[model samples]
Target: MKIEYADRMRTVGEMGAWEPWLEFFVEGIRTQAAEAVAQTNDL
Candidate 1:
């Protein structure tokens, strides 16, 4: 998602696209939480 974030950050100053950027950030958090849960379950 580093590439995705880089692409979004570039256009974030253009205006009206903040919603997608926020969604991307939230999705990243959700993804990390899921991975952490799975790792804990494995132990």
Candidate 2:
């Protein structure tokens, strides 16, 4: 599923109003990934 960011945003907008939710979702994923890496290094 290769889609451009703008395309994805458009689709999401079409589905419903969720811009903030999407932002939080991406941020959460990033934070979790960073935490995972840090924990692995601490081992």
Candidate 3:
């Protein structure tokens, strides 16, 4: 995840590419939401 973040930041900084970073951020949010739902169900 650290490497992936670095790569994403590099693209955003070097090429002014926002889509990849936006996608990555959205996926991370989706993943966290899924985990939260699972944990709530478990509880």
Clashes of each: 0, 0, 0
Writing each residue's lDDT as its tens digit, candidate 3 over 1-43 gives 9899899999999999999999999999999999999999999
- lDDT value, candidate 1, whole model: 0.89
Off by over 4 Å in 2: 1-15
C-alpha displacement of 31 in model 2, angstroms? Answer: 0.7
Q: Give the RMSD in angstroms, all C-alphas superposed, for model 3.
A: 0.6
Clashing pairs in 3: none
Error of 1 at 43 (Å): 0.6
TM-score of 3: 0.91
Q: Model 1 off-target regions past 4 Å?
A: none
Residue 3 lDDT in candidate 3: 95
TM-score of 2: 0.57
lDDT of 2 by residue, 1-43 (tens): 2344566667677886477557756887899999999999999
Candidate structures ordered by lDDT, highest first? 3, 1, 2
| lDDT of candidates 1 onward, in order | 0.89, 0.72, 0.96
* Sliding window of 10 residues with minimal summed lDDT for model 1: 7-16
Residue 35 miss distance in model 1 (angstroms)? 0.4
1-43 per-residue lDDT for model 1 (tens digits): 7899988877787765888898999999999999999999999
